[model samples]
Target: MAYQVIIIEDDPMVAAIDRQYVETDSRFQVAHVLKSGGEALGVLENCRPDLIILDFYTPSMDGMEFVDRLHAMGQYPAIIMVTSANDREIVHGLLSRGVLDYLVKPFAFARFRQAMDKFLQTQNLLSCSQESSLLDQQAIDRLIRRQERPEPGGNQMSKGLNAATLERVRSFLSASRGQALTSEEIAEQVHLSRITIRRYVNYMVETGELASSIDYHTGGRPSIRYSYTGQTAEP
Candidate 1:
């Protein structure tokens, strides 16, 4: 079954890009593209969407207010917030109010695809037969986790490092162009540990999406600096 998706974003370009992204997946359909919370609220009253891709800032009303109104109307659908806002307090509040996932602005297609796939996985789990075992319940819990999952080909799942997150780190660096970033710096931006980021950076360098150079110091240990190669990072 194709999942219905509603996108509420004000910027025409961003909305268009989002719609294009949704079109790439056959399992999802773009049901509506409203520019404001008020417009979405009206249409969503009768439209039963399985998911909503929301923007934080909008005319007429904002995403937060729209969510509040949806709750008031008792319309509960999974929400994936796409916005430039990175305020921790706002994110905490939104998660508390039932947001399924959060994606910062300027994210690449890989990250977006990962989010959609994970949501689909959750939906599939929810539709499982009622005679579910404890193992099935555990699997469902893992699927419902907000974190990205490793690609099937990778054997490093034990590290909690996923291909999507690795691509995210690569995409972030690609956006930086020629700037050299340390593992610590990348970790800070990507919200991963220094070790995890370092592993991904090395893997990217091996795969040729990025190149690494040694930064020598007088007495300290030489540091590795990573730069984007202006190529696709897909393995």
Candidate 2:
């Protein structure tokens, strides 16, 4: 079953965008879109969502008050803050209260995707711990290290290249197998901007994770197509 998510943003447009980003990953579903924390609190017990995308400022109740109320009610859903508020005090307070991730307003889709990936990773680790009843040192370390870390590619990724986004592109190309696709095509499939997709594809090609070829059938300047190389880069 897909994990349920609730979005709490007073702005309708931002709420729609949050829903779009959340639904891009097949593993999650938006369970509710509420305008304020007061409305959210009304349904939290019944909905019991796994995650929430929240804005700091709202009409009835602010983000901090919402969090405090949740704690008082003994409900602790994972939260990813997406708001214009960048005050250091607000951020520090939310972090101390265990918000899973924070994104300032005007953030890119890649950054949003990264936050969702982190939440999923944490959920997976928690599930494993529940089944085993005991976690090894490595497992504990992974849970504690919430910050983004380079994966698959042992070296740090280049600027603007996110590991989660790169993996999404790689996964799509790998599934395509025999067919190679241009950046635009891949972007459409993966719900990422073409330029972002192109950057990742180029990085993957350099790392030997993808192979590229020129396609001249368009009757204009030849376009480059990428395919998974069937080889994993050595760390």
* Best candidate according to TM-score: 2
Error of 2 at 151 (Å): 2.6
TM-score of model 1 relative to the true fold? 0.63
The Cα local distance difference test for each model comes to 0.77, 0.81
Residue pairs with colliding backbones in model 2 are none
30-67 in candidate 1: lDDT tens per residue?
Answer: 99999998999999878989999999999987778889
User: What is the model-wide C-alpha lDDT for candidate 2?
Assistant: 0.81
CA lDDT, candidate 1, residue 199: 61
Model 2 / residue 218 / CA error / Å: 27
Residue 74 lDDT in candidate 2 = 88
Q: Tens-digit lDDT track for model 2 on 1-235? A: 9999999998866776778667655578898999999999999877788999999999888899999999899889899999999999999999999999999998765567679878988887877766678889887898889645346656647445687887888888889988888878999999999767866776666567777665547665456677888776646
Which pairs clash (backbone N, Cα, C closer than 3 Å) in model 1?
Answer: none
